[model samples]
Target: MRNLITFFILNLLCQSLTVNADELTVTLLGTGTPIPSIERFGSSTLIEHKGKYFLFDVGRGATIRLSQIGMYPSDIDNIFLTHLHSDHITGFDDFWITGGIWQRANTLNVYGPDGTKSFVEHTQGAFSLDAFYREKQSSLNLKGLEVNVTEIKEGLIYDEDGLKVSAFRVDHGAVEHAYGYRIDSDRHSVLISGDTTYSENLIANSQELDLLIHEVSVIEPKLLQSNPKLKSISKYHTSLQQLHKLVEKVKPQKTVLNHLLLIGSDETELSHLLETKFQDKNIDVGHDLMTIHLR
Candidate 1:
């Protein structure tokens, strides 16, 4: 009788663990650079767990990419913008349009750096003519679509339902203030290094995180020589070597590379270089619609 009771208790514990593990799902909807690439889309990630959906960035074609993965703009619970880069936010209008057209009941909560509120307001105003025309032509009510924008500095932005999100400023060239987000749930935590070069803040915030989704841009001397414009732009991005050092410090369980540009000649070389540098960690290059089931 005692043995049977112990066995049942262990079984119950295992089942509970399984249920918790199965609830969290993350998908990279688009994983490309500013320059168009046939194989990759722009930078956008969708994180869903326990009926909650969070979008990290709305790069170009984010709506279409999300739809490709069987997710609608209506499914998003929150939209977090890392910065105001054109590549990261060009799809904001699309997301707004789709949400309104679909008649989504939930208001879109957009969080970002200091200038976010005004940026959103400007985008909304730019669409005013279209919104007015649509309302007059079709019976669709455009005024009801609410876009709640919150400009964040640092510290806790959201905490609810066993999930906590913290944002911290990161170093990204002249992009006045950029942010890196740390998302903690009951079971796991992930850090998103949104378009940062290299920062001690990001390293400290991301320590021991389960996953570190960081951007990688190849800025080797040879590559830079070929494209002078890239040299100027690469200052704001993280190189493969720099990323390797970041992984070494944070020592995350997994490092998923997004916003890749000029990843050397071949994918294997980039992967090899990263692996040789960070021997203990697993590195993954992100692709559009790639789903990762977190444990």
Candidate 2:
């Protein structure tokens, strides 16, 4: 009877640990493009796990959305970038400067592609005056303002305290080394496909993804005919049609359409079109500050 009771207690403990191990929530902080929208901000996502925060792609207005969630610039110590596009990295100034002034003790750990270090260096140089002003005013630590950049290739970049982040290369048109990232914990896994056309690497890595956040564009026939410029743009991004094919292959538990570029069709129209194609799967358009919990 004692052995039976011990077995029951041990099983309960194992179940509890498994459930607690992968507690995470993802929030779409910004979901707009370089072409501004009042409703949507730029491209940014926040992953919050066990009081620690990780930011992916800090685009315009990311700090504002972060504010909505009660998170300040200093709260996010780790940031991962998919590529070095202007729209994606524009929030660096807000994050670094605000954090530098407010919470100077924390450090910003940035991970990205080959040019990441150079980009951070130049950005810091641009904000040299601001840093100097803060330094003169207060004896703040200013360490949080310091960005530690790790330029990554197609492999594991971060693994600490039971969470793992892996980076893989993807095709984003003329961009040389764009990437997608897979973040895994004990009970849940997520894949973030930062602006890409279509990637075989993404499909292979996403077999176990609980949630997949991917960039998508709308390419309607009328839009292409109306604006010749869209033809060039279409080559660089994944259309709703292409995304349909991708979702069919990856078959994630849930798929989110992010970095949405609305050319001719509005968000509502585009969503209905995509939903028709993905009738068998769960898919939704991402909006700023939308949060999803993964258990």
Against the hidden true structure, what lDDT does model 1 obtain?
A: 0.82
* Per-model root-mean-square deviation over C-alphas: 2.6, 2.2
lDDT of each: 0.82, 0.87
Candidate 2 lDDT tens digits, 221-285: 88797887898888778987788888888889999888988777788887688667778779998
1-295 in candidate 1: lDDT tens per residue? 9999999999999998767854657788778877886667777888877778999989888999878877778778589989998888888889888888777678889999889888889988998888888888886676446788888879999987777889998989999879988988877888888998878889878866788889888756787889877787888888877887888888888888888876345567777777677667788887788887776
Give the lowest summed-lDDT range of ten residues in model 2. Answer: 98-107
Model 2 scores a TM of: 0.93
- Shift in Å, residue 85, candidate 1: 0.6
lDDT of 2: 0.87
Top candidate, metric TM-score: 2
Clashes of 1: 0
